[model samples]
Target: MEVDTLRLGFIGFGEAASRFAQDLSQAGLRHIVAYSPSAAKAVLDDAIRKKADDAGVELLKTPKAVCERAQLIVALPPGSKALAVLRRVRPHLRPHHVYIDASTSSVKDMEQAAHMLDGVAPFVDAAVMDPVPINGIKVLTVASGSHAEQFRAALEPYGMNIQVVGEKPGAASAMKLLRSVCMKGLAALLFESLEAAQRYGIADVLAADMARFINGRPFEQIMKRFVCGTAIHSERRIHEVSESLALLKSLGASTRMTRAIRETLQQITDMGLREHFGAREPETIAPVLDAIIDAKRAQRT
Candidate 1:
């Protein structure tokens, strides 16, 4: 399939959605439309109008309207809100249309979504493997589903590092979920350990040691991979961590670390770091960690 002619619709015109649409537009694939529930009609309409005027694309009014205009729909809404959006647009889905979920949702949610859209439209679980802000055109995508092959063919023209994981509806999301177990868990561990060091009045020394411990393979590097890697690509890292916890439980392994990681991510989310750090590189988190250490030290003093 020629990407140049493919009509793409995006639900959730936040940073990731906008970035994807902008990237595609720059690539000369102009048949794109986007809708954002957060953007007021006047605001969204104006932004869409500017994009349309600048790039020659349409900005539709509703999610269903966008669905109606494109053969491929990329759902990039928040993890918690993804299912509701899916339910809303499910009825408008057509047999020829391919729905790609780029959100961070549970394996169960992905499976349910697949079941709901079964026989109506092909559903693909596509996890964004990197942050679109950092990776830009080189974004890596892990996709799985019965229709993954078709979806890959359609997305090729946009120039992506897309990998097809399997023919299962939730395989891609599972892969991402498992990875979050290690990645996000490490971030939380780093935060806790560093804070403890500050409590001991050895923060500087520990930070230096941490630099060496992670040296060529530092925490920042790994985090960069996760933040710039998965966060921007998929909106579902939190739910993915939950799925990883389930995997650990099935294996009869303790979920202490997973649970701690989930809590820390929740902290980050609650602090609104998701918006600030979602598309930032790993290095961007260093200051946040430093501030955390400082606050802990002040409390101790």
Candidate 2:
């Protein structure tokens, strides 16, 4: 079948799904259908409804409508909801169809999801490797499955950078998680290290010290600037991180590292260094940190 003729459908019409639909549209795939489990959101949220309409995405109400309209269905629900999303679409799946899971699933979890689809339809595990907003649909992705090549063939024509890692079901997911560990660990370390430098009133020296380390990470450019600027807006960062912790708590998701970093930022904020640079960012980290020291000494007196 021609790529142009294929009907692209998304199971979750959230941010990722909308971006992919628009990207595919740009690549000459004119027909796109999307459905959300919260289909009622269209009535409640004008922005969401308008987004679907703007992307040329035909928003349907049921998984059955989504499954029936398109031969390929991309499941973009949250990792935790992957099984439920699949179950909802399961009754409508045919052997001729393909279900590509591009959710945040663990290796074992992805394997279970694939096993759950046994004999129903071909299931491909897709590991999203970069932020979709910045990279667009060309965002690097690793896909693994019995139908890996088939998945690549259909999508690569549409600006997707899909490579087959292995056919072992969860191989792509493993690689993605390994990459996440390194990148997120660097973010965590960057924040903590800067907080240490701030404490000693030597943050400027540490910025130069960290230049050597930042050049080696995956997202070095972005991470370096973020590391250097986090303290200038420490109060905002603390509040944002706190809200993130609250969000994860509400979701019943694991927040061990999130809580750790949140508390770390909280310490800096409470130390009176928050927005210490005022409306402008200082060239050296020492200016703001010196303010922190002055404030702390004043408190002691």
- By TM-score, the best candidate is 2
Candidate 1 contains a number of clashing pairs equal to 7
Report lDDT (Cα) of residue 33, candidate 1: 83
Clashing pairs in 2: none
- Worst lDDT run of 10 residues, candidate 2, spans 219-228
| Per-candidate clash tally | 7, 0
Instruction: Please give the TM-score that candidate 2 achieves against the real structure.
Output: 0.69
Q: Where does candidate 1 have its weakest 10-residue lDDT segment?
A: 227-236
lDDT of 2 at 61: 83
User: Across residues 14-70, which tens digit of lDDT does each residue of candidate 1 receive?
Assistant: 767777777777877777887776442746446645655464556677877887788
Q: What is the lDDT of residue 3 in candidate 2?
A: 77
lDDT (0-100) at residue 262 of candidate 2? 79
